[model samples]
Target: MWKEAAAGASPDLEFRAPVDAAALAEAERRLGRSLPGQLTALLKETNGVADGYGTDIVWSLDRVVEHNLQFWSPDTFPGLYMPFDPLLFFGDNGGGDQFAFVLTPERPDIFVWDHENDSRLWAARELKDYLHRSLLGEGDWYR
Candidate 1:
C-alpha cells in the first residue's frame, strides 16, 4: 500500500490498484503518447493501489472511470478519487491548460495530463514532493 500525508488534511491518503498491461497499452494508444518508462515498469511489478498508507486511491483500470466515464481510459491508471480543485493546479486556457494527475498502482510518481500544453511531466521524486512544493505552494502563478 502506498500512502502520503495530505497537505490540506493532516491525515494520510491511500491509493491502490492492480497493473494491467493491456489496459495500459490501450490508454497509451488512446492518448497517443507513451508513458514514462519508470512508471510502466512500476505498474508491471505492483498491480494494486500505490499511494498512501492504507487508503485506496488508485482504482483498477477496469473500475476507474465510474465517475467520469467519458474521460476514463482502460489503459490509464485510476485516480484515488480525492476531491481537489483542478482549477488550482490547472490554468484557464479554454481547457487547453488543464491537467490531471494519474496515480499508478505500482509507484509513487505521478502521470500528469497537460491538456492545454499537450505534454506529460513525470516526477523524478515521489509525487508528494511535486504536489507539496510546486502545485500546492504560493509561488509565481506561472511556472
Candidate 2:
C-alpha cells in the first residue's frame, strides 16, 4: 500500500487516507485552522503518505518521503527545500484551509506551498530537523 501510494499513480500528486473525523476535529482544535473541503474529501478516501521501501507508514499527522532515483540528479535528488508532515503541521496549526501536501518522485523530500514564497521543497533532513525542533524546541538537527 505504501509503495503503491508512494510510487503509484496520480496527476494531482496527492495521497489519500480515510478521514478520521475525531482526529481531524482534534487537529483543527490544536492547530487553530480550518481544513478545506477538498482536502477533507481526500483524507476520507486516503489514509496517509506512502512510505518508500514499504516499511515506514506515516499516519494521519505523520509524513513519508518517496525517492525516485531514476530521475534524480545531484541538482534534483537532494532538494534544498523540505516537506512537512501534514499530520504534524496541520495538527499543530489546527487545520489549514488550503491544500498544502505534495509529493515528488524526483526529490528526496516533500514539497509544500509557502504562503510567503508560494512553494518550497522540504528535504528529508529538514523534516527530521523540524521533527526534532518540534519535539525538543531547540536548535536544528537532521536525522
Candidate 3:
C-alpha cells in the first residue's frame, strides 16, 4: 500500500530492498535522533527512493548518514545547515535544499530547510504527506 502510494506519485518510482535492523540503528545513531514511526516503517520497506525521472531522492540509509555527517557540522563546507538544529534530513530537493523531520515535536513534523534563503518552514504535517506531496511535486514549494 505504501509503495503503491509513493510510486503512484513519483515519475520514475524506483524502489529499493528492505534494510535490516542494524542498518536502521546505525542510521539513527548517525542522525542522533530516532526516526518517526512512519519513516522507520518506510525505510524498512525501501531503504530509499530513487526517482529515475530526474527528481529528488529520498536518501538511502548510507546516503542519510553521509549527508548528515557532511552538512550537520560547523563550517566544514559551504551551506546554511547548522549543527544545533534538531532536524534529521531525509531527502533532497535536487536543488541543494533538503527536507527533514523536526525533532522538537512529540510526533515529528516535516519541514523544508531552504538552502538558498537559509530559512526553515513547515512543509508537511507528517512523513507520509511529505513523501506524497514531494513525489507528486505538489504545493508549489518553490514559493
Model number with the top TM-score:
3
- Per-residue CA lDDT of candidate 3, range 1-143, in tens? 55776877764778889888998898888778777777788888987886765554578878777876766676665444455357777887887778887666555678888877678888887877877778767445635
Residue lDDT tens for model 2, 1-143: 33233343322233554758887676556545444443354455565433222212223542311221212224553555343333222212112211233332322242333434435434233333322332333222111
How much is the lDDT of residue 58 in candidate 2? 29
Model 1 misplaced regions, further than 4 Å: 1-11, 38-128, 134-143
| Candidate 2 TM-score over all chains jointly | 0.33
Q: lDDT of all the models against the reference?
A: 0.39, 0.36, 0.74
Which candidate, 2 or 3, has the higher TM-score? Answer: 3
- Measured with C-alpha atoms, the lDDT of residue 71 in candidate 2 is 20
The candidates, ranked best first by lDDT, are 3, 1, 2
Task: Report RMSD (Å) for each prediction in the order shown.
Answer: 10.9, 15.6, 2.6
lDDT of 2: 0.36
TM-score of each model, in listed order:
0.33, 0.33, 0.82
Residue 118 displacement (Å), model 2: 12
The model with the greatest lDDT is 3
